[model samples]
Target: MTLETEFERVSMPLENPFTISRGTQTDAENVIVRVTDEGGMTGVGGAAPSPHYGETAETVEAVLPDLLTAVEEIGDPHALHAIEAELSTVVTDNPAARCAVSIAVHDLAAKRLGVPLHRLWGLDPSAAPATSFTVGLDETERVREKAADAVEAGYSILKLKLGTDRDRELVEAVREAAPDARLRVDANEAWTAREAVRKSEWLAELDVEFVEQPVPAEDPEGLRFAYERSALPIAADESCVTLSDIPAIADRCDIANLKLMKTGGLLEARRMIAAARAHGLEVMCGCMIESNASIAAAAQLAPLLDYADLDGSLLLADDPYDGIPMLDGEIQLGAQAQAGTGARPKSVE
Candidate 1:
């Protein structure tokens, strides 16, 4: 079947200025992708490029022509394996761009089959864990307010971004604000090994569930040092990028954090999850700041994940697209009545 393709960029402001250890973000840029089958069945997807991973909206737009060109050549959305394999060769990097195409193709394929994307993979929707709402770094008081707000909004789990000298103060404030919330912290490669180890102790004291990417990914030995000594379970985000990195990180972290934008496609993401399981690592699926276009695709994998941080779409001040339903932070994947990834454009004013 012949296919058609197109993409466009969108800029959306965050509800709050989102700050992490490395920096703050007032807005996010997403590149949206679409693939249409011969019968005019259209699939939608998006790319939320991360500068930390060496991608931006500009780069994603720059590479889509070639990636979508490969899809046109292949002429079939059902040939998921062949298309994904070809995408890798078409552009060795720009995973976020490739990811957009992958998502759209998968959406179209599942829609064509008259099933949701998760159903296509045979995943049990009820197995999905509640997603964690992120409290980006801020002054201790503002951070506390954010935590309180998240809890008020019915987020049962909270992932607080930490990396300042006031890390303890921040955690304490959040812990005070969200006493019963399942807590996780991500340092974004900001801490030293010793600092991570030390912080992990206190974080555990606050009843935190885990710490993520504490030490710089550039330091494997440091990660090992922290992982061996930390009181809380450690999740490897920056340290784990692909299926190849899974085995290497197996011994260094408790959780293997996977991002679709980082992995490039749904097939590779499944492979990473399997590889992580094989290596005895707990699996988490996180997302970059995004719209429902890509977050919906990520949510389809929630059933396979031990942890879910697919709240990227939730962080936006407003989203042009809506995806899977969420009730008190639990992803309602089965509630997605539409076929494919279950993303649809929100009504415009």
Candidate 2:
């Protein structure tokens, strides 16, 4: 058997400027990857690198050729373990690039079996959590308006970016607009332990479900302090990057937030989930600002997550590829009739 591999860089504008504690993004740059088997069947995936994680489109592009070379060398879609293991040897740090190939290989393997990705893994589609639409950091009024728009668009869960002097005011604005929506907040490591504990009390009063990454990953003790004192549960994103990090954070945070770009691939993501659960931490899956090519792959693991923040594709102004159907904020993995990850060119769909 022979495999053919190719990739392209794509840039798409966001619906609006997306800001977090770290910075803002006006556009999402992704590297799309495709791998084909000898019989002409193809798998699709993408890499949406985050600069915060020390990756960019250029880095993803630079690393993919080597990763894809490894995929083709294996020439077996079912050899995911071998392909990924080899990919790690090729480039250990470029996880997003490895993730793209990981996704493609998984998609291809599922397609060969003629089953949806979640189905292939025996996950119940109904078990998939409804994804939260994020309200990026912005002017108070604008943030309120975005929340209203999300409710109007049928997202029942809303994750708000909170990491500023006016964090309370910003969250209040969103609550005023989305009184009934399930709310979660991400500070993106902007606050000290004392400040996080203080804010968590008021945020709880406003019915926030949790506080995510209030303290930076570098300060593990701060995270533990906040977790011990905060009124609301804390989720660790920046703090929990890999399976190894899970043990360290298990005592510090209530939730373990995993992302494909950070984990490098699907198989490792599941392992992380299990590890988090064994450590008695609730698990959540999040994503970078991305297109459906990658977000769709993340959705496949929705059933395994306690909270789903897979709204990356929803932030895009437009996407060239269509993945799973997400109607009314619920990730409808079974909604797709076609096999694989439900990612294909919009033209093909």
Candidate number with greatest lDDT? 1
Over 252-305, each residue of candidate 1 has an lDDT whose tens digit, in order, gives: 999999999999999999999999999999999999999999999999999999
What are the runs in model 1 whose C-alpha is more than 4 Å off?
none
Cα lDDT tens digits, model 2, 199-282, are 999999999999999998999999999999999999999999988999999999999999999999989999999999999999
Candidate 2 local Cα displacement, residue 204, angstroms: 0.7
Instruction: Please provide TM-scores, in order, for all candidate models, with all chains considered together.
Output: 0.99, 0.99
In model 2, which residue pairs have backbone atoms overlapping below 3 Å? none
Model 2: CA > 4 A from native:
none
Please state the error at residue 128 of candidate 2 in Å.
0.5
